[model samples]
Target: MTRTSRRWAIAAAAFLAAPVLAGCAAGFDATTVKHYSPTEARATTVRGIQISQGFVLGPEPGGKLPKGGSAPVYLSLTNIEQQDDQLVGVAVNNAGTVKLAAPIVLPRDKRVSTSGAAAPGATPTAGTAGPPLVIEGLTKELAGGEYIAMSLQFANAGAVDLTLPVVARSREFATWAPAPAPTTQQTPTTGPTPAATATPVPTATATLTATEDASTGGH
Candidate 1:
């Protein structure tokens, strides 16, 4: 085609596409929906045992984690009793016996292995993975004792305090890193001497690179 004819054809195609594009965008505004939801007030609990899964050992607030990350306490819980109960507030104690103000949330997931996990002393196995509900901003609350302890407060369930066993938390598996091999250091002293009878000393320090056990935890 001639140059002028080609230009005219291009203009005509542009004009034809305008209406189609306009139609596609025409009802977009009306189809858009507004979203709204009211802020929910926290719930209160009446009565139920405060059960937990993972055990927080001498856990401390503001303490350092291994990977230079925010230290967090992994948690899960349930009412244990048949009847449902409300959960209210919680009190936390740091490495001391004193109490600290805190909020308690029994963030339980039915999708998880209900029976928390085996204790860390078990064999290694595939561990659980899921969205963890941050119970709350946990910090040291109380003072008096040398160790940490948390007391949960509820409206209905005053002190049906429950003890949730420390299930295994297998970052890699749902078991402990296999029981540590028994050391020979405590074997015996060839000849006993009062001052020399200290703990058995190994000639060399050897690091374990791999496990020799054939069985313990599942892959």
Candidate 2:
């Protein structure tokens, strides 16, 4: 072959192989890269119930509760099922007792919230108020930027466990304070009264003796 033809052939081969070499260096793996973005809230769905925007409000300024103190959990639940379901109980690991004042009835195609104003309903315009799930008798002091494992029990859906985030009480969460503890009225106690004592009648005898002495003196 001629020198010029050989040089041209070598240049062509180099140009064609450059892209293949680059592709190999960049890794030809077929896996897709997943990008994660920070979110202000989190959510999960179990059965026909959608539990979203789950968060815990931090204690008030200088009002942080010690270990064994309680906190409130806020979340919105939506029932997509045709039948109604009831939220029977809640549990937290390493946390205090979880108590719901009453079972939460989730109507079909309805959303229930524990933080914001309730949706307008029939009859009265004030809407229906939903109570928050309170965690009483905490086993550890809970603060902002922490997470606790919690499980929710439903009458028909069984249980759903989640890792809920703890956020400070600020901005939107400022109003999500825990419900006031129930007050107890104590009955007043009474003590026994002592009986009155009577004085002796000897005073009358002394007065008579004095009068008799005065009459004798006058005589």
lDDT of 2 at 99: 69
Clashing residue pairs in candidate 2 (N, C-alpha, C atoms within 3 angstroms): 96-137
Clash numbers, per candidate: 23, 1
Task: Give each model's whole-structure lDDT.
Answer: 0.33, 0.68
Please give each candidate's TM-score.
0.27, 0.61
Please tell me which predicted candidate would have the highest TM-score against the true structure. 2
lDDT of 1: 0.33
**Reference-based TM-score, model 1:** 0.27
Expressed as tens digits, the lDDT of each residue in 1-219 for candidate 1 is 999999999999999999677666755322112111111101223244533343332122222222211112233345555554444554444322222223333333211111224223221112322212112332433111122245555554575332211112223223322211224667665875557557877634332322423233434
Off by over 4 Å in 2: 1-39, 61-63, 119-132, 182-219
